[model samples]
Target: MRNETYMWKILAKTEPEKTLYEHTLDVLTVLKEMMKIFPDVPKLINEPNFWDYVFYALFLHDFGKSAKGFQESLRLGKRWGYRHEIISAGFVACLEYESEIKKLIALGIASHHKEIDELKSKYSTHRKNSPGYERYTKALREIEENFGELVEMMKLIPDLSEEFIGKKLTNFKIPNSLDELLDVFSFAVKSYEDSKSSGIDRVVWLKHVFMRGFVLGCDYLASSGNLEIPLLKNEISEIIRFEKFTDVQLKMQSEDMKNKDIILVAPTGYGKTEASLFWVEKNQNDRRTKRVFYILPYTASINDMFKRFVRYFGEDLVGMKHHRAGYFIYQSFRDREYTPDEAKKFANAFVDLSKKIYKQFKIITHFQLLREIFGLPGFEMGISEMAGGIVILDEVHSYDARVIGLLIEALKILKYEFGARISVMSATFPKFLCEVFKRELEIETFITAEEEVLRKISRHKINLINDSILNGVDRIKKFLEDGKRVLVVCNTVKKAQEIYNVLKEFARGESKLIHSRFALIDRERIEKSLKNESVQILVGTQAIEVSLDIDFDVLFTDVAPIDRLVQRFGRVNRRGRLNYADVFIFTGYLDDDLKIYDKELLDRTISELLKVQRINEVDILNLIESVYADGFTQKQSKIFNETRESFLRLRKEIYPMLSNKIADEDLHRLIGSIEIVPSCYENDYLKMRESGNYFEVVKFFMSLAYPQFFKLHRNGQIYQHSHTLFCLAGYDKELGLLVDEFETNILE
Candidate 1:
C-alpha cells in the first residue's frame, strides 16, 4: 500500500510543492471568493444546490493525480499517455450523484485538461498489453484505496457535510471494469453535447458551462497561488457620482429606461457618457444585472473611458480590459510607490484577478464581448457573467460593416437570449443604422439631442475645398499663424505625415502629429499633451475620429464619409462656446485616398456639406442617412452576411464539437491588426525585459494594420525580434511612425 505521505509528494515541484490536501483547500477557498463576488451565480443557474455540486467537483478534480502510477510519472518527468482528468472522471462516475448531476460533473472533470474529441480518442481504444493500460490499472487500484481517505479528510473540515456535502459518505464503488468506465464517460460526453445541441433548457446548459469555467478558474487560482482574487464591491455608492447632469443627461435620467433597451443619438461632448451612466444608475437596483460592461470600439477610447469611469467609480470597482490590459494594469501599479518586483507581482495579480472575476464597471473593447458570443474556451464564464449585466455600447458608429454585423448579433444574444440590458450610444448615430436596429431588435427608446441643443452644439462653419490636401496646408498654416488651434485630418497615415511635415515648418506654436501607427504609449502621451495644451497645430488620421476629447479652433480635413467628417468636426469648437469655428473640407483625393474611402460617399459628403454652410448636430443624422441610404454595397453586404453566417455556424455547429475548431489567432487575423515594437526601441525593450518590467514597456508597442505590416515586410523594412515585429523605417520620437517615400504599394 502507498503511504499517505508518499502520495502527498506525488505531484511535487521545487517552486512550491503544495500537498494535494492544501491545493484542494486552496481551490475551495477560491470558489468561495468567486461565490462572494458573484453572489447570484447560484441564482443564475437556478440551482439551490449549485454550490454543493461545485464543491464536490472541486474536491475531486485532482483526485486522479493521487494515483501511484501518475505520481511516479510526475516524479520522473515522464510522458503519461493518459491524463489525470480521465481518472478523475472515472472517480466521479462512482459518486452517488444523481444521473444528471453526475453527468455534468463527470464531463467537467474529464474536460478540465482536454476537450471532448481528445478525451474520446484517448478512451475509445483499449490495449491490455500497452504501458498505458498498466498505468491505468494501477491508477484505478490506487483510487480505490484513497477514496475512503478523501472522505475521511472531508469530515475534518468544519460543517463539511452539513454545509456542502449534505450527507456523510459511507459507501461508494468504482466501475467494475475499464470498459464500463469508458462507457460511462462516453455516455456523459454524448448526453451533455446532445443537450447543448438540442437547446433544451438553456439555463441548464449555462449552468453546466458555468460549472466547467468556474472549476477551471478555481483550479488555476489554486495551482498558481501567486494572486488573491479580489471581489468587486457592488454597493450603490460604487456607481459614479456626478455633481450635475447636462441637459441631455437630465433628459436621460428623467426618462423611464428601466427594463428597456435604449439607443441614444447625440453629438460629441453632449454628456452621452454621463447619460449612459445615469441610466445604469437608475436601474442599479435591478436584480437581473450582474455587472456593467461599457464597450468601446478603439483601444484608445477604452483607455480614456476606463480612466474617466475610474474617477466616478473608484479604481477598485473599475477595470480596463484590452489586448494590452496587462500594460495598463502595470502602469496603474507604477503610479503608486512600489518596488520593481512588487509592482510586477501586483500587476500580474491584478490582471489575473480581473480576468477571473471581472470588475463591476469594466471598460472593454467589443471584441471581448464577441468572444463570449462565439463560445470560445473559457467563454462560458464570460457569457454567464454578462448574461444579466448592463452593456453600454459607446461609439456604435465607428465599426465597419463586418464588425457592425457581429455587434448586432452579439447584442441580440445579450439582450434577447441572456436577459441583458443594453444601451447603444454614438455621437453620430445614422438614421439608416437606427432603422436597421428597429427592424431587427425592435428597439423603441430612441433619444436624440433636442433641436435647440443641436443648434447650440452646431458650432462649425463648413467650407468645401475642391483641391488637394497640399492646398489645405497653406490654410492650416494661416490658422496656426493666427494663433488659432489648428487640427488637420487626413484620410490616410501617409497624407497625415505629409501634411504634418508641411505644417511643422510653418507653425507658430507647438506642432504635433498623431496616427494609428504610433505606439500606444506615445499616442496616449500625445493625447494627454494635446488636452493640456491650449494652442497647437495637431495633425492626425482617422485616429482622431471617436472618443478623443481634444478641441481645436479650426479644422482642415480631407472629405470622407459624412459620419467620419462629422466626427472630425466634433473635435473643433467642442465646448460650443465660440459663435462658429471654420472647418475646411478638402474634396480632392490624395495617394490611395479614393481606394481608402468610397468615392461615392465622399461625393455625397461634399454635396451635403455644401448645402450646410453652418453644420449642426441635427444636420448630422440626415446627412448620414443620405450617405448610407442604400446600406452596404455589394462587397460590403457580402462581407457582412458572411461574417454573420460564420458567427451563427460557430455558435450552432462548430462550438458543439469536442475540439475547439476556431483559433483565437484566426479571429485576430480577421480583425486585421497586429502590434509591433519598433526596432529603434529594441534596446529599451530588452532593458525592460531584463528589469522584469516588460509589461510596463508593452504600452509603447505600436499596432499596425495588416496591409501596412505586409507592405513593410515585402520591402524588408520590418524585422522580427522576440515575437515582436520591428520596423526598419524611420520613426520620430515626436512625429510617431512614418511611411518612407520609396514605398510603391501604399495600401490603396
Candidate 2:
C-alpha cells in the first residue's frame, strides 16, 4: 500500500522538483490575492459558491501527474504523449457535489490546459474497447491507488470548507473502466452546448466563463512563479495632485466626468496623456476598477508610453503587450544594466506575466485587445481581466474605417456587457466622427481645448513647392549645414530609401532613415540615436508621423490626406519654442504615390494646401473638415459595415468552454502581418534557438506585411523551419528592407 503522504511526492514541476502539494499551495495563494482585488468575481455569475468551485478545480487540476507513465516522462525529461488533465478531471466524479456543480468543476479542470475540441480530439479514441483503453485503464488504477493520500493532503488547506474536509471522499464511486471515466467529459460538453443554445442558461454560460477564465489565470500565474497579482498603487492620483493641469486636461478631470463616457478633442501638444491619467484617477477614486488599459495604434507609441508609465508608476504596477513586447521588455531590462542572461530570464517571465492577469495597468496595441472579441485562445481571461475596468483609447482617429467599425462594436459589448468605462481622445477628431462615437458610446462629456488656447499657439507656416520632394536634396543639405534639423517624409518606403541614400552622400552631420520594415532591434537603436542633437537629417515614410516625438526646423513631404498631413506638421516646432517652422509640400509625384493614398483625397489635400499659406492651430479643424467632408468613401463604408456585422456574429458564436480555431485563424488573417527572419540572421537564429536562448531568437524577427510576404514567398524567397519563417529578402542597417527584386535576388 502507498504511504499516507505518497500523493505529496508527485512532482508538479521537474526542474526545481516542486511537489504537487507545494504547487497547489502557491496557486491558492494567488487565489487569495486575486479575491482581494476582485471580490465581485463570484457575484459576476450570481453564484455565491463560485469560490468553492475554484478551490476544488485547483486542488484536482494536477493529481493525474501521479500516473506511472507521466512520472517516468518527467523524470527522464522526455515528452509526455498524453495529457494529465484528462485523468485529473476524472477526480471530479468522486466529489459529492450536485451534478451541475460537478460538471462545471470538471470542465474547468480538463480544459484548463487544452481547449474543448483539442481535449476531445486527443482522447476520443480512448473509450471502451478502443485502441488506448487498456492504457487509460492502467492510468486510472494508478490514480485510484493514490486517491486516499490525495484527500489526506487536501485536508491541510485552511481555505477548504470544514464540511468538505469531513466528507468521506472515498465513498464516492471510482471509475472501474474507461467508459465510466469518459462520462464525466461527455456530460460537461453536453451541458456546455445546452447552455449556449438556451436563453435561460445565459447565467450558466457566464458562470462557466468566470470558472474557466479565473482558473486559467490563477494556474498560469502560479506556474510561472508569480504567486500574487500586484495591487494597483494610488500612483495616478498622486501625480494629478502634484502636477499642474492644462486647460484641456483640467476639463477632462472635472468632477462631472466621473462615471461617464468621455470624448476629448485636443491638439497634439495639449497634454492629452496627463488628461487621460487624471480621468483614470477620478474613476479609480469613484469606483472599484479592476484594471486599466491604455490603447495606442502603433507599437512605437505603445513602447514609448510603456516606458513613460513605468517611470511615473513603478515597473511593478505597469505592464505592456504587443507583437514585439518581449523585445521591448528585454531591452528595458538591459537598459537597467542587467546581464544578458538575467535580462533574458526576466523578459520571458514578464512577457508571460503581462499577458496574464497580474498587472494593474496595461499599455497595449489595439490588436491585443481586439483578439479578445475575436474569441482567440484564452480570450475568456481577457474578458474577465477587463470586466469592470477602465479602457482609454488614444488617437481614436488613427485607425482605418474597418478598424473603426470593429472598435464601435467591441466597445458596445465592453460597455453594456462587461461594465467597462471608456475614454476616447484624439487630436484631429472631426465633428462627424465625434457624432458617430457619441451615438455608439453614449458619451456624456465632450471636452475640447478652447479656441482661444489654440489661437494662441502658432507652430507652422505651410509652403507649397512645385518640384518633387526628391529634388529638394540640395535644400535639405543646406539646412543641415545651417545647424537645422531637417525632416523628410515620403509616401513609399522605396522613395524614402532613395532619398536617404542621396542625402547620406554629402550630408555633414549624422543622418538616419526610419520606415516600417526594419527589425525591431535595429529600429529601437535608430530611434534612440535620434535623441542626439547632432543628428541633423532624418528621412522616413508615413511611419514618422506618429512614431517619434521631436522638433524639426523644417519639413518636406509628399501630399497626403489633410489629417495625416496635420500629424506630420505637428512634428515640427512642436512646442512653439521656435517662432515658426516652415513646412514645404511637394506638388510632384509618380503614379506609385497614388497607390499609397487615394487620388481623390490627395487632390483634396492639394486643393486645401493651395488655399492656406500657414497652418494656424485654431483653423486646423476647418481644414480637416473640408478634406474629409464626405466621410468614408462608399467602398470603405461597405467594408466597415460588413466587418462590424460579421464580428458581432462571431462574438455570439463564441462561448466559454469551446475554443474556435477559425476565430484564431481570422485574427491572424485580419492582422495582415507576419514575423520573419531575414536570411542574414538564419545562422544566428538557429544557434540561439538551439541553445534555448529564445529572447535572442526573438530579436532577429521583423514584421512584414502579408502582401510582401506572399510575393516573396511565391518567388521562392521565404522558407519555414521549426515554426519560424526565414526570408531571403535583403535588409540594410540604415535603409531598412530592400524590396527591389533585383537587390533581394542578389542576396539569394
Candidate 3:
C-alpha cells in the first residue's frame, strides 16, 4: 500500500521535483509577492459574491495539470501540448463544490491559457454551425459529467443576499469600470470560442483571470530565495520584518502622516516609495476607498511603482496607468463596444477611466490624471468624476515654480472638491507648501525631528562638479573606481548622450547612458540594468532621480531649479549609510531669455546653490526662501507673483462648499482660468501616434489640434509626454522651423 501511494508521497514532500505541484506552488508564490507590490488587493476582492469565487479561483487555477491528456505521455506529444486547461477544468468539475466554484475553477484554468476575448466568445453560439459549438458543447458536457459525482458529494455555501452579491460585483466591477468587466468577460468567451476547433470549451472571465494571475504570480514568487509566503498566523512577523526600517526613515514617514501635505526634503536614494507605503500601511485600512495614488514624476518612476506595486499589492490588483501601458489598459476604445462618435464624446475619458484599475487600492502616476482631465467633448463629464481619490505626488520639488504652483492648487481642488487625500513627498518641500497645506486641510503632516533628520543627513556626503562634460565624466570615473555606484544626470537629452558617449570610451567597468530619445524599450532596459549593479556608472536625464532607486554611492547633476536641485541631492547618500558616495553638482550658465522668462525662480534657484558641488536640502531651500525674500513670490511681481496670488485667491473663493454640493460647470469654469496644460489628450493622437510614417503622426496631430484639446503649436500646452510613454510637439522660430517640444513626464 505504501508503494502504491508513492506519487502521493512525492506530492507531500516539500521538494516536488519540478512536477505540476511545484509549478502550482511557484504560481502561488509569485502572486503573493505581487500582492506586496499591490498591498490593497484584499480590499479589491472584499466584494461579497466574487471574493469567495476569486479566492477559490486563485487556489485551484491549475489543479488539473496532473491530468493525463495534459501530461502528453508520449515523446512526440510534447510539442503539441493539448489544451491542458480544458483537461484541468474537467478535473476541477470533479471536485465536490458549488457549481459556481467549479465554473470559476474551469474559467481560471482555461483563461490563463487564452484570455476570453481572444476566443471570440460572443459570436460562438451562432457564428457557425459546427465550429465554435463543438468545443463549447463538448467541454461543458465533459465538465458536468466528470464533476457530477462531486456535486453530489456536498458542502453548503454561505447564504448570501442577492443585493449583497450585486453590491460586491458593483464595487468589483465599477473601479475597473462597468464596460471593462464586460470586455474582459467577452474577451474570455471569444478566446474560448476561437479555440473551439482546436478542442477547447469555454474560456475564462474576469474573476478567473484575477485569480489565476494571482495564483500564477504566487507560484512564481515561492521560487525566489529572498521571499517567502508567511502562513496565515504569521502576518505579524511579515509586517514587523517589513517595518524593520531605519528610525530616520520611520520618523519621516510619521511626519508625512501627521502633516497634511509635507515633503521629505531629503536626498533621492532613500527608500521613499517604501517609506510612503509604510506611512499608508501605518495609518489605517478602512478598505472602503482606494488610499494611494503614487504620482511619480516620471513614467519610468511609474514603471518602478509598477514593479513595486506588484511587489506590494499583488500583480493581479495594481494597475499601472500611462499613455502606453497597454498590457493593463484598454487597447482601443473605438473598437466594438465604443464607436468613433462615442470615442469623440466619451473617447479619451472612457479610455482613461475605463481601465480595470478602479478596482485596485493603489494607483501610480499623476500624468494619467492629467490626461483624464483633458477629456474630449462628452468625455469631459466622466473624466471630471474621477476625483475624490488619494494622490501621492513624489518628487514634487523636481517641478518648476509655475508647475509647482499649478500642482499645489490642483491638489487643494482635488482635496476640497473631490475628497482627495493628497500627499506631496520630497526631500525639499518649500515652507510655502507647508503653510499652503495647513490652510487647505486643517491638519498637515510634517516630520520635525531635527536631530533625527540630521542623523540621516550626516551619513551623506556632497561634492560639486561644475566643470565641463569631460570633467563630469572624469569625476564619475573616479567615483566608480571607489567601488561605489555613480549616477550622472543632465538637463537635456543631448547633454546626457554626450556624457554617455564619453563615459563609454573611458569606463572599463559597467556603464550605461539612458535618455528619453532612445525609445521606451531602451529606457526600461537601462533601468533594469541599474537595479542589479552596485558600483556601475549611469548617466541620463532627470529620469534617474524619481523612481530609479539604485543604491548609488554618489550623484552628479546639472543645474536645475533649487527645489529640483534638492531632489537631485536627495538621490545621493539617501539611505542613511555612511558608505554612500557624495553628490557633485554641476551648473552652467542659462541663456538670458531663460533667466528673464523665469526671473524670480531663476534668481531663487541660482542664488540657492552657488557652488553646486556641495549643498543639501537646508542650503538649497534656505537660499530659495532668502532669494524670494526680496518679494519674488510677493504680490508686487506681476506675472508669476500675480499668478501665485491669483491661484490662492481662486482656491479660497471656491473652498467652502466641498461636500459635493457644488456644480460641475462652476468647477470647470473655475479651473479653466489658472491653466496648466493637461498631460493627456482626448484627440486621435494615440491612433495617430502609430500611423508612424513619421510625418503622418505629426500631420495628423496638427490637423486635429485646433478645437478639442489644443490649437497646434500652442506654447502653454502641458502635454502628457513619455519617452516610451507620451510626447508633445511644438513649433520653433530660431531658424523658422519647429523642433521636438517636451513637457516633464516620466522617462520610461
Candidate 4:
C-alpha cells in the first residue's frame, strides 16, 4: 500500500521535467499576475464568482495527467492515447458548486486543449463495454488510488475556506462510472453550445468566452516563463511632440467625440497618425486598461509603425505582427551582432510574446487582427486581448471588396460584442465605404481636415495618356534626362519589370525596381533605398501605393480605381513641397492591366480623371465619390455579400470551447499565397537547411501569389526542398523575379 501521506507525482512537461503540481502553481501565479495587470477582468465579465470559476479551472486543468497511462507516456516519451483534459474535466462534478458554475469550470478545463465539440465527437459515443469506457474506468482507478494526495493539494488554494475544503474532500468519491464523467463533460458542452443561441444573454456569452480564453491564456503564459502583460500607459501626449495640433488632430482629441467611433478623412501629410494617437490618448485612462491596436494593411507599413510606436512608447510596450515578423525581428537583432541562434531565439520570443497578451500597443497588419474572427488558432486569447481595445485602422481604402466585407463583419462583432473602439481613417476614403461603416458599425463621427487647410495643398496635375505606359519609354527617358525624380507605377509585376528593363539603360540617376515578389532581404533593401535622394527613377506595381514616404517630382502610371489613383498621386509632391507635379495616368494598358483591376472601375476612374486636369487636395474626396458612386459592381457585390455571410455564419459557429483546427484550412486558402526560394538562392537555402539555420533560410524566400505559383509549378520550374519550395525562376537584385527567363532555366 502507498503511503497515505505521500504526494502523488505527475509530469506536466518533460525535457525540463516540471511536475503537474508545480505547473498548476505556475499557472495560478500567472493568473494572479494577469489579474494585477488587467484588474478589470472581473468587472468586464460582470458575473458573480468569475474568479472562482477561473481559479478552479486552473487548478484542476492538469489533474488528468495523473492517470497511469498518461504518466507512463510522459516517462517513456510516447504519445498518450487519450487527452488529459477529458479526465481533468470530470473533477468539476466533485466540486460542491452550483451546477452552472461547475459546468463553466468544466468547459474551461475540457476545451483548454481541444474544443468541447471535438471531445464530444470523440467520446460521446462511449458506453458500457466499450474501449473508451474501459480506458476511462482504468484511469479513474488510478486517480482514486491517489485521490487523498490530490485532496491535500486542494488545501493550497488560498481562496477556499478550510471548512469548505475539508467538507468537499471528505465527501468526494471516485466517479461511480464513466457515465458520471461523461455526463459532467456533456453538461459543459451543452452549456457552451446553448450560449451560442441568438436569445442567450450577452453576459452569458461573455462569461463563457472569458472563462475559456483566460484559462488558455494563463496556461500558455505560465508555460512560457514569467512574462508580464503590460497595460496602456497614459503618457502618449508627453512622448509624441508636435508644434501645434492640426484641425483634424484637435477634432480627434475633442471631448465631444470621445466615446464615438470615427471616420477621419485626412490627406497623406495631414498628421492622421498623430490624430489617431490623440484619439487613443482620450480613450486611455487609469480607471481601466484597454489595448490599442494600430492596424495597417501592409507589412512595410506595419514595420514602419512598429518602430515609430517603439520610439514613443518604448520597445517594451509596443509589439507588431505580420507574416514576416520573425524575419524582421531576426534582422533587427542581427544588426546588433547577435549570433544566429541568439537572434533566432530572440525572434521566437518576441513573436510569441507579441501574439500573446504581453503588449499594450500592437502595431499589426489588419490580417493579424481580422484572422481571429475566422477562429484561427488561439483566437480566444486574441478576442480576450481585444476586448475594450481601441483599433486604429489607417488606410481604410486600401483593401479589396472581399477584404472590405470581412472587415465590416469583424468590426460589427468587435464593436457590439467585444466593445472595441474602432477609428477608421484614410486619405482616400470613399463616400460609399463611409456609409457602409456608419450603418454597420453604428458610427456617428466623421472628422475631416478643414476645407481651407486641404485647399492649401494643390499638388498634382493629372495628365491622361491614351496609350500603353510601356509604349512611352522615351517619355520616361526624357523625364530622367531633365533631372527630375520620376516614379512609374504599373498594375502588375511583369509590367514594372518590363518598364524597368527598358529605362535602366538610359537612366540619369539610380534606377531600381520594387514589387511584392522580391525576397525579404532584397525587398527591405529596395524599400530603404527609396529614402536615398539618388534613387530618382523608381518603377513598381501596386506595392508602391502606400507605406513609402518618398516624394517624386512626377508620376507615370496605369489608371486604377479612384482610391488607388489618389494613393499613387499622393506619392508625388507628397509633402506639398512642389507647387504642382504631374501624374500621368495611362488610359490604355497592356492586357495585364485588365486582369489586375476591374474594367468597369477602370473606365469610371478614367472618366473622372479626364473631367479635371489638376487634382486639388480638397477635390480628391469628390473624385473618389464620383468613381465609387454606384458602389461595388454586380460581381464585386456578390463576392462581398458571400464573404460577409460566410464569415458571419462562421462567427456564430465560433462558440467557446471549440477547436481552431476547423478554420485553419479555410484561413490558409483565404490567404492564397505562399513563400518560395528563388533558384539563385537554392544553394544557400540548402546549406542553411542542412545546418539547421532556419532563421537565415527564411530571408531567401519570396512571396508568390497562387496564380504565379501555379504557373511556375506547371512549367516544372519549381521543386520541393524539404518543406520549403524552390523556384527556378530568374531573379535580379534590381529587377526582381524575371518570369520570362524561366523558359531557359534548367535545374542542374
Candidate 5:
C-alpha cells in the first residue's frame, strides 16, 4: 500500500520527470486565471451550478493518466495502447451527480485529447474479436485499479475534499463490467453528437465549447510550466485623453452610434481610428459589446495598430493576432529589462495567453476572423466570442474583387447570424461598394466628412509626367538637394528597388527602400527609420499607401489605380502644413502598367487625374467613384459570383458537418498568400531554432503572394528547406524577391 500520509505518487508527467499532481495543480490555477481575463467565461457564470460543473470537469480531466498502463508507458518512454482520455471519460461517467452535469463533465474529458469523430471510431463495436477490443479491455481494468487509488489520494488532499467533489461521490463505484463501461462511454459520445446536431440550444452549445476550450487551455498552459498571466491595465481613458480631437472626431463622439453599424468615409488625417475607438467606448457599457476587433488588411498595418491600441488600452488589455504576432509580443517583452531566461518565459506566456484569450481590444488582420468563419478547428470558441462584439474594418477599399465578395459574405453571417456590429471606414470608399453594404446590412448609418472639413485638409498639387518612371529621378534628386523630404512610390518591388539604387547615390541624407518582400523585422526597421530627420529620400511600393504615418514634402509615384494614387499622395503633406506639396505621377511602361493594374481602370484613373489640378480629399473620393461607376467587368463579375457562392456554400453546407479538422490549405489558397523564410536567413534560422526562440525567428520570415510563389516554385526557383523555411533563388537583399521576373496571369 502507498503511504497515504506522504505526497501523492506520480501518475503521469507533461514534462520529463515532472509529477502528474504538480501538472494538475498548475492547470487548476491557469483555469482560474483564464476565467478572470476571458470575457466569454462570465456568460457561463449565470448558469445554475456552473462553477461546480467547471470544477468537476477540471478535477477529473486527467484522471485516466493514473492508470497503471499509462504510468508504465510514461516511465518506459513508449506509447500507451489506449488513449487515457477515454478512460478519464469513463471515470467521469461513473461519478454520482446530476445527469446533465455528469454528461458535460464526461464530454469535456472525452473530447479533450481527440475530436468527436476520432472518439466515435475508437470505441465503435467494442466486441472481444474487434481489433482494438483486447487493448481497450486491458486499459479499462488498469483504470479501475487506478480509480480506487485516485479516490484514496483525493481524500488526503484538502482541496479535493468531499465538499468540492460532491458528497454524492462518497460511495462512487467504477463500472464492474466492460459492457457497463462501454455503455457509459457510448452515452457520453451520443450526448455530444446530440448537442452538436440540435443547433437550437445556443446555451448548450456555448457551454459545450467553453468547457472544452477551458479544459484544453488549462492543460496546455500547465504543461508549458509558465503560469504568469499577462493582464492589461485598466487605462482606456489615459490613452484617449492625450490627443486633441478634430471636428470629425468631436462629431463622432457627439453622435449616438450604439447598437448600430456605421459607414464612415473620412480622409486619412481625420482621426478615423479615434472615432472608431470612440464608437467602441459608447458601446462598452452595453452587455452585447464585450470585445472589439480592429481589423486591417496588411500585417504592417495590424502591427502598427496594435502598438497604437496598446498605448491607449495598455499592453495587457490590447492584443495582436497575426502571423507575426508572436514576433511582436517578443519585441514588446524584449523592450523591458529582464534577464535572458525571464524574458523567454514571459514572452512565451504572453504569446500563449493572447492567442488563447480574446482581449478587450484585439488588433488583427482579416485572416484571423476568416479562420472563425471557415469553422476551423479550435475556432468555435472564437466564433462564440465574436457574437455581439464590434468589428472595425479599416481600408475597406483595398482588397481585390474576390476578397471583397468573400468579405461581403462573411459580413452577412457576422451581422445576421452572430449579432455582431460592424463599422467600415476608408478614405476613398466608392459609391458602388457603399451600395453593396447598404443593401446587405439591415441598418447602416452613413457618415462623411463635410466639404468644408475636406477643403481645410486639401494639401497637394498634382503634376503628370508622360515619360517613364525613371524620368522622375531628376525631380527626386532636386528635392533631396533642396533639403526637402521626398517619397517615391512604385507599383512593383523591382521598380522600387531600381529607383532606390539610383537615387541613393544622389541622396544628401539617409535613403531607404521598403516593400512587401523584405522580412518582417527588416520592414519594421525601415518603418522606424522613416521618422529619422536624416532620412531624406524614401522609396517604397504600395506598402506606403496606408497605416504608415510618415509625412514628406514631395511625392513621385508610378501611375496605377486612382484610389492607390490618392493614398500615396496622402503620405506627403499629410498635416496640410505645406499649403501645397508637389505630387508627380509618372506613367509606368506599358507591360508593367498592365501587369500591376487593370488596364481600363488605369486609363480612367489617368484621365481623371488629368482633370484635377489640385488633389484634395473630396477630389480623391470623386475620382474613385468615377473609376468604379461601371462596376466590375465581366470576368471580375464571374470571379466575384463564384467566390460568393463558394463561401455561402461553406457556411450552409460544410460548416455544420465540419469536425475539428479544418482544411487549412484550402483557406490559405482562398487568401492568396503564404508565409516563407528565405534561404539567406538559414544560418540565423538554425541558431534561433536551436536556442528555442521560435517567436523571434518568425520575425525574419516574409509573406509571399501565392500565385507568384507557386509560379516560382514550379519553375524550380523555390526550394523547401524545412517545414517552416523556404528558399527562393531570386531573392535579393536590396531588391527583395523578384516576383515579376517569372509569373503567370494572376493579378492583385
Candidate 6:
C-alpha cells in the first residue's frame, strides 16, 4: 500500500512550516474534492505509472520543513523566519543528474510557497541563460547526497521513465529559441487537443512541484479524520423523484434555457441540483470539453451540495472547498524521484487537478469561480483549467448588489469570452436580476417554473392570508396549535429578532431562532436543534431560506420581496403533502428603508396579479415573471448600473478604514463619501480563519456565527471579519484600510 502520511522528519515547531502545512492542506483539499466533482480519479490511479509520479510530487513538496530555522519560526510563531526552504533545496543540490532534471525539481519545490527570483540573482550567473538555473543546480546536488542511496527504494516504473525522458521539461523558463518555446507550450497549457489526458499524460502534466503538492494535500486531510464530505448522491435522486420532474425535463427546455446564458428563478425545493445533473447527463462526453462551476451563497449550502455530488458521483470525480472548517484538496498517492531539497514541486497540483477536470469533467463550487472571474498572482493557469465547464450560480438571488454585479461580469466572460455556459438558479429572482441577464448577455434565456411549475410538479396550495405583523405572530401560533412543525421567515435581521421575541411569549418550550447574527457553530447548533421531533417552531431571517434539507409543514413570513416570499413558501409542503398549510405574506407595516425595497417588490407583484384579475394567476412565480416583463426596460438599465456602481462605491468607501486606524473626526467624511453607507465588519468578531481562497475566508466568517456580515465583491474578493485579513492582507486589510470604525476606500 502507498504510504499516506507525509511528515518532514526534523520539523515541528516553526512558523514557516506551519504556514506551509496550511498551504499544503489547502492545496490537497481542493484536489480531494475531486471526488465530489469527479469520483473516478482514484480508479485512474490504479495505473502504475500515472499514480507513482503524482504521489512523488505530492509527498516531497515540503521537504524543507526539516530545517532548523524553519522549526524555530514555527516554535516562536513570529514574523521573521529563516530560509529553511533553502536548506530543503540543499537536499536537491547534492543530486547527480544526467543534466539538470533533479535540480529543476528542487527549484520547483523551493519556490512553492514563496515567489522565486531569477536564476541570475541567486547564482551570480547569467539569468538570461536560465530562468531557474540557480535553484536547479542546488536541487541536483540534493538528489545525489540526501536521496542518492534510496534510488533503489523509490518506485521506478518503465512507462513513467519513458514518459518523462521522452519529453524535455524545464522550469519557469520560456526558452528564447522559438522551437524550444513552442515545444514548452505544447507540453503544458494546450487545450482540447487531447481530451483523453488520463494516465501517463496526466502525470506528466503534474510531475515536478505539482506532484509534491498532491502528497502534502492528502496528508493534511488524513490528519483531520473528522472532516466531512457531503453526501449529495442519494439526495439528488431523492430530490428529483420527490419533486416528480417531468420526463421532458431530462431534455432541458431548449427555449426556456437553450444554447444561451440564463438565470433561473424557480421556487426553492424545485430539484435544481438534479436539473444540473440532467443537463450534464444529456451533454455528457459531448460537454466534457467543459466542467461545472457550482457557485453557492453559503458554506453550509456548499457542504450540502458537496454531499449531494459525493452520493451521486462517488469520491473520484469531485473536488471540495470547505472554506469554514479548514482548507484541503485530495489526490491519489504513488512513488518516485526523491530529493530532500527538491521539494515544493507540488504547489501547482490545484492547477493541475483543475486541468484534469477541464480535460475530463468536474463539479466545483467557488474554488474555480473566484479564480475564473478574478485573477490571482501565481495561478493564472487556472483560467485555462476552467475552460471546459458551465458556471452554475445557485441561490444567486440571495446575493447583495455587489455579488450581483460580480456575477453579471463573470457570466459575461464565461459566455462571450470563454464560450462557456452559465445557468443562475434560485427560488427567488427579482426584476433587476432579469434585466441584468436579459439585457447584458450576448444570447440569453429565462426559465422560471415558479409557483405554476411547483404546483404542477407536486400539488401545494399558496394560502396568502392577512397581511399584518400580528398576523405573522398569529400564523405561528396556529401552526403550533395544529401540531405541525412551523417555519417562520422574515426579511430583515431586526424584524426577525422582534418577531421571535414576541413569538417566544406565545410559543411553548423548544422553539428556535436562527439568523445571520449567531456564530457558525451557533447556527449549526440551531440547525441541529431542528432534527429533534420535539422542536416545533423555527423562526429566522433570510438565512434559513434554502440550501438546507430541513422539512417543515406551515410557513409564516412577513411581507418580503416576491421572490423571497416564494423561497420561504418552498420551505413548506416541499415533499408531496395534501392539506398544505397557509402561506401568509404580511405586507402592511414596513420601515422606511425596507419600504422602498419591499414596496417596489410588492407593488410589482400586486400590479401584475391585477392585470389578469384572477386568483389563478396569483402564483408567485407568475407574479414574479410578470413583474420582470412589465417592469424591466431600457429605462431600468440605469437602476442596475446605479445599484452595482453604488455597491462598488460603498465597498471602496469603507475598505480604507478597515486597513487604517483613522481619526474619529474623519469618520463622518468617510461615511458621507459612501454611496450606500457600507456596513462595518461586526463589532465583536474574531476567529482563526482556516486558510483557503476568498470563498472559504467568507465561509469561515459566516461559520464564526458572530453576526458576521460579508459582501462578495465584484472583484472576486469576499470581504468578512476574520483574524486572517488583518494579518495576511488577503482581503486587503492593511494600513489606512479603515477611515474610522466604519469608513474606508476601495481602489476599484
- For the record, the alpha-carbon RMSD of candidate 1 to the native fold, in angstroms, is 4.8
lDDT of 1 by residue, 562-632 (tens): 88888898888888778999989888875589767767777777777778788667677778888788876
Give the Cα-based TM-score of candidate 4 against the true structure: 0.90
TM-score of each: 0.86, 0.90, 0.49, 0.90, 0.84, 0.56
Model 3's alpha-carbon lDDT is 0.44
Worst 10 residues of 3 by lDDT: 173-182
In model 4, state the lDDT of residue 183: 46
lDDT per model vs. reference? 0.72, 0.78, 0.44, 0.78, 0.71, 0.45
RMSD, model 2, all Cα superposed? 4.0
- Candidate 6 positional error at 184, Å: 17
* Alpha carbon deviation, residue 440, candidate 4 (Å): 0.4
Cα lDDT tens digits for candidate 6, 1-748: 1213544234433433344444443334444443343322223323323333332333345544534344445576653233434444433332333223443344444444443332213432224346444443443333333232123222322323223223222222212221221111112112211232332233232232133333333444434331333323332234345345643354353334435555565545546667665554433333132355677766667666765765566644555543332222221111234231222123134334334322233444443454433333233234433333467778776764434665676676556534466777776576656665678775455655544445555434454544656556765686677677877877665566667667766655577787755534345567766778676777777777766566677677766656666666667666657455456555564673263254565666645534432122135556677666655434345555675565344322211001112332232232221111112333222222232232222322332211121232333333433323321112211111111133333321
For model 4, residues 367-470, the per-residue Cα lDDT tens digits are 78777777776678888878778888888888878888888888887887777899998898878889998999989889998888877778999889999897
What's the number of clashes in each of the models?
Answer: 0, 0, 78, 0, 3, 111
Deviation from native of the Cα of residue 630 in model 6, angstroms: 5.6
Residue 315, candidate 3: how far off, in angstroms?
A: 2.9
True lDDT of residue 723, candidate 3: 26
**Candidate 4: minimum summed lDDT over ten consecutive residues — where?**
161-170
Candidate 3 displacement at residue 137 in angstroms: 41
Error of 3 at 637 (Å): 7.7
- Which is better, 3 or 5, measured by TM-score? 5
In model 2, the clashing pairs are none
